[model samples]
Target chain A: MSAAARRGVLPGFGLSTGFTVLYLCLVVLVPLSAVALRSSSLGWQEAWKVVASPRALASYRLSFGASLLAAAANVVFGGLVAWVLARYRFPGRAFVDALVDLPFALPTAVSGIALTAVYGPTGFIGRHLEAAGVRVAFSPLGVTLALTFIGLPFVIRTLQPVLEDLDPEVEEAAAVLGASRWETFRHVLLPALVPAATTGFALAFARGLGEYGSIVFISGNMPMRTEIAPLLVMTRLEQFDYAGAAALATVLLLASFVLLLTINRLQAWTRTRAGAA
Target chain B: MSIVVREVEKAFDATPVLRGVSLEIPDGELVALLGPSGCGKTTLLRIIAGLESADAGEVRHDGEDVSARSARERNVGVVFQHYALFRHMTVEENVAFALRVRRRPRAQVAARVAELLRLVQLEGLKGRYPQQLSGGQRQRVALARALATEPRILLLDEPFGALDARVRQELRRWLRRLHDELHVTSVFVTHDQEEAFEVADRVVLMNAGRVEQVGTPAQVFEEPASAFVMRFLGAVNAFKGWVEGDRAFVSGLDLELVAPASAAHRARAHVFVRPHELDVHRAPVPGSFAANVDRVLPLGAAVRIELSAPGFGGMVEAELDVRRSEALALAPGDAVHLSPRRVRVFPSREDELDSLTASGL
Candidate 1:
């Protein structure tokens, strides 16, 4: 018998497996490997120097730090938004629900320009804020704000279904057992929501790290300040330094992949613990 | 603690769910709110538990009015139909939740959790999560969790409704024993009449958002207050007829029904008979109706005979012991006689009698 015939009851197992592996390699692995190979041609010492320069290091810190801050803010406010969308009914609820996906559906560059217009020094809400000695545009905070705007939908969308599926009976059960509303939330509801919320946080954070279009318009791109790693890679490419751009892109890709993998593992752990319970 | 619910009324979006529901549950009594789905039994239980508020009513615990209090303030415990164990917690943690939420000492929480685990016979599975346990075990965990704080009253909403028949039976017996041991003022809602009769001290029958009757198992089973209760108790046959001269003159049956003395003057009535109370005979007899056997079904210990009379539009059922049915050799098209050993007659309300006859009962 042929190996394919002996594989299982299902037919064409070998052919399907071969196709799947080939498709993944061509679509995902090959492009990623090309970046690594191109960066390798620069020689390790030069590549290291390029990625670890004072300017490059500052950009790295701003990119990762702003992404972290944006993800943290989204976890709080995005969770509230998701909870409201899932649990309550108010005027324009359907409209507001549709609006959550605006970040995902709007062109990133359009959102960037819109956010800049709204939060610019002379803009609608920003004029009052600037007079109050707060600046949201053309700074590191502006970059973070832009990232937050783009990342909002990731967290809300991820947590919405999980929140909706959470049984209200359990909360009522807790209340009837003498837990106050806060206690019921903290002890019963929060524990069930944590895994999904963490997954959302990770997703939002990953999206923020790679965000380029939205940040470029709002961020002033000042070296060692508002400049982010993706912008630094783009600058390198514009300067005709392919190896430097490839190295920077490879570093961002590896860092994000590692962090996202760790977060995914954390989410899986929580899910398993919840399943076991 | 004893509970008294006074004329509780509730509505959902203008559709009335509970209409002036009132009941008194004395301390240490286990009552079952029995009804079909959508009858508002579960809603009434929720009202008493303080999980839901009545539009107009007062709920009192031990003579203290708690209508304005929240569920947390009322100190009640509720077990949901699907167990509702916290999926993120271990069995021990779920049982300990009430105490822990109250900020009880760690040692005290541990001790109480251990005690409850033992009570629920789940000591060995304390560290396991709800998903790791079988349905029966999850329900036991839910029960233990509810009982953790020693709440004055415990409410369960169709506690075994999610389990299969075998597991449901096992859990029913376990719940009966647990109630005996705890003796908390408890009320559980269930649609299963057998479960209600077997497990509850008293059964409160409900229909169409109204309390039909409240009595002990025997009382409700033997002397249902209304035709609705009689039919809901299951395996019942209703005959639309008139009662006069101490006999019920049914439309289709040739035999005369022995009506209760009090029902003798009623011009119109609905007479009900349970299948088991009916006897099937090979030869026609006085006070018995002639019927043609439509089918014979062996139901484990007994045989159910489906019969149809010439003039009766609907079929009547009779159950006989397995061995006796075998000796009689009853079959389809065989001529037989049926005599009801027990019957209940209620004065026919115009709407109810119309519905009963329209349903071909």
Candidate 2:
């Protein structure tokens, strides 16, 4: 077929392509490049020195570390929640399923306050944990907890459909072929679910990295201890330290972008592993 | 091994799927459970394979009871209609799965897999994934995987149903040949009568979750036990009337259809005349019914002529060779005489009692 005939079949391709490029440039590309331009006002050496400061490096460690830890924990618990919702039926099952998305619907600052109230030194369950010598509300652990709460919806939403779409016949085939129940799960079911689970993990991890509103109230913001990267950028901006703020923001942006790019490459590999299984 | 099922019953969520089904298969026989959808053929197969437990039944293999055994313990191989081959695994790995699960030596697994790939004529595609292969190739891989452990019994549920017609025909012949060579007791479920007859030594016809008849293909087709069986193996003309003694009186036509010796006296009767059994002629003959030709369909090997008899509510079909049709010069609106060479008499079904709705043409 000629190009015009082919194009006629799907009439709005050029319109959609132009609209997508224009919208993406306006919303995302321009803002990201503006941040880069702002950081370049301080020369490369000056920006590098600002990002390499002890306070900035400490904040990076806490922000990235807590986000990584929280996302890993979410994969395990979120996967369990998704499987239960997808595979089982009980009284109030629908209510439990709806409850999983509460984190997404709640305002992030409200989540921060709510989590602080629940995990503060004198709160319910927190008093018992405090007596057991585990301080939570004003520690780095609190920041991880806040990130975990906000990141859970991403994993559960991504994984629920994948778990529900799995064919029960494949499991039966494995059983009749003399595989044990555990064998069927480990060999057949796990392989089919891995790609979707990986995708969910990546989304949750990325969300956790950019998290700020929920962590401020929980994390005490102690320099070189519990302070996170986004809080450092905000503090620099508040103090009229524009160059310092730009440097910190640029470092964080690069780290998130590189993490997302690597994750996409890994997802492509897992997708091939999980197809049709 | 010989297998016997005694009074199997199953219900899904208070809905009865199988009601008191039972059967027996001698060793080395390839049997088919043939029926339409929802006839409990697949459910029965699952019960026999130990993948499903009957609400009430006892399944015995080689005179040993294994009703309580799990599917993994029963050691029966099953293939599904959709070729449930693992998508992530290569053909070689899929075939080797069962042996590997059993912790067989690596060398033995490899050798057995190679042999099975050869059996299915898919050795050349051993390294290919299930998605990379065609439907026929994937199903062949499923078969090879099911055969890996050499289970005493093999059960297949509509194994070739997902393939195209041409490929289904080829696989049907291939499965029959494989059974002949191995002589392993096998049971396959199918909705296709032709495939069942072609592959199985004995055909068990089922309806409404119960076995209607069990016999060789020739016996079931030639001597149907019930009117339902006769109607199911269709393309035959049914003439409804009444049976008295050894003769059936078709109300519209003056001809008297001779009833079989096994016929029973009934208020409403049906005489089944296959298309090939009706001999068409140009001249009016004694014991022949007069009919007007409605339409003629050329079916390659044989020509099928449809006739609407005067006073009859439904059309009667007659099939003859190409030469016979040409000689008679049959056409639309032509007057023709038909004499049935053979007919089977059975009580007409409830709907067939009023001939208008029987054909549904």
Candidate 3:
């Protein structure tokens, strides 16, 4: 048989690939192209003026900086939560596991409202912190708090299954060989977990970078201080500055794609290492 | 060195898995805990290895109580039925794991691991992972790993039970040689009587969470302690009868009492004789008992002739050599005379009804 005949039955390959390419053109590539086309209608000098403005630059710093902060925080604490949920059989474990998926299921607007009620100065936890003189809402810190809240499930869900799939027999064997608990986790468990943890971190980061609805109510979107990129794009659109809005959106979109691509590369690399081992 | 287990008892929920099992194994002796499934043999082995806790017993190593010690602290090596070799590590790395975990010197570990590979006769295969090896090779690697720790006692749970028939026999012989070379106080658990008899110096037959008999292989196979052991070893012709004075009356059968005079006074008794012990001949031998061949089986060198006779309700098996078989012209319908040279008679285990599960009746 010829090579074409040999390749006749790759299951769902043609249909799924066709669907993926069309969906990307409609939802991702076409929209990105439209954003680029609209941004290009502005003269280069004018586009530079809109993008490099001190207000725009400050939004860049806060948005990217706060998202990084949130993603970093999630990588550590989210991992702890995932490990606990995966390894232990505590009372109300089901409830706690369900709570990890709350961010995925609940509307971002509802989460924003709930978080504002709880963390706003007049709200329950806010009052206690206010007495301690630590202001949270309407600050960049509050933007980070919102992003962390929405991004946590990405990290935990990605990691929990990987940790759970790892066999405890490996650990038992290690212990029987005279290795202590710390050494076993380091030598055996951690090597297997590295890939999953990295994937989780990348997911949380990408999600935080594009987050808008959840942070808007809590951030108090002040220009040059608390305004983030997504909020800035909305402000330009509301003012009918289409060129400026499109330019900013295009930049954010490109940054997010690059970050996600890099993460995907790392994930592929990790999977290869796991398979090789 | 020497391992002593005393009053070992364990219970899972309300069901007792082990009931007061006791044994003393001398240094360099390879003893086998031999029994059928759920006989508490594996449980006893785990208890000695410190992988499991005994509820009411003590396991001592060199006269020191190590019952409460953790598996890691006990410094005993164990080989599981599945080998349980780490899939991620090469043969050398797996064998070296115990020494590495104990934080031995790197140079010494390398040398010792090399020595162990040679000892288990897998020198060139050290670089391969467990999944890359066959079942027999994996078991050998497991044995090598267990020895790598320089453990005083090695516990193997059905180590060769997973292999094919030919491989199982080959490994048993190899294990006997390995035990002789290592001289560790090794305790292996197995249900296959053939494996136990072949590899172990002392065989402990367990039944229903208790040690039924403990002796050399020949002793246990030849002189069983109870009906369970006797039936488990091989087929034995038996009769239930009542004893009166110096004679025993076998119900529904006529035979002179051959049991001890002490057993002659017992109200009820069970008389047993092995199949191969009965002598069968074609012509009417003057002193031989009378019978007819009910069935015949040619089992390689010997022909097993199952006989039925008048006044005896059950069939009795007698093994004859090919020469004797030809002389007798043995067939299913032929008349024959069977003379049993040996018999064992014991008092009825009627009281065992109350503790049915424990007595293994």
What is the lDDT of every predicted structure here? 0.88, 0.86, 0.83
Give a tens-digit lDDT track for model 2, residues B1-361: 8989999999999978888998999999999998877778899999999889999989999999899899899888788878788877788888999998999999999999999999999989988888888888888899889989998798999988888999988989999999998888999998788889899999998877788889999999988887667766657888777766666667644445553435455557767889998899888877688889999999998999988996655688899999998899899999878887877778656543211123342
- Looking at model 3, residue B350 earns an lDDT score of 59
In candidate 3 the C-alpha lDDT for residue B42 amounts to 90
Model 3 TM-score on a 0 to 1 scale: 0.80
| RMSD, one per candidate, in order | 2.8, 3.0, 4.9
Query: For candidate 3 chain A, which ten residues in a row score worst on lDDT?
Result: A1-10
Comparing 2 with 3 on DockQ, the higher-scoring candidate is 2
The digit string of per-residue lDDT tens for model 1 on A1-277 reads: 8766667787787888899999999999999999999999999999999999999999999999999999999999999999999999899999999999999999999999998899999899889989999999989999999989989999999899989998888888888777788888888888888898998899899999989999898898899989999999999999999999999999998999999999988888988988732
lDDT of 3 by residue, A28-138 (tens): 788789999999999889888888899988998898898888888988899899999999999999999999999988889888888888999998898898889987888
Q: Best candidate, DockQ-wise?
A: 1
Q: Which digits, one per residue and each the tens of the lDDT, describe model 1 over residues B1-361?
A: 9999889899999988888888888999999999878888999988888888999989999999998998888888789988888888899999998898788999999999999999999999998988889989999999999999898899999999888999999889988988898899899999889999999999999877778899999998888788888888878888887776556667644334444636546578778888998888888777678889999999999899988876654789888899889989998999987877876777777655222233344
What are the runs in model 3 whose C-alpha is more than 4 Å off?
A1-79, A82-87, A131-133, A154-168, A223-229, A232-277, B234-251, B254-361
TM-score of each: 0.94, 0.94, 0.80
Scoring each candidate complex against the real one, what DockQ results?
Answer: 0.78, 0.74, 0.30
**Model 1 chain A: worst 10 consecutive residues (lDDT sum):** A2-11
Better model by TM-score, 2 or 3? Answer: 2
Q: iRMSD (Å) of candidate 2?
A: 1.3
Per-chain TM-score of candidate 2, chain B: 0.92
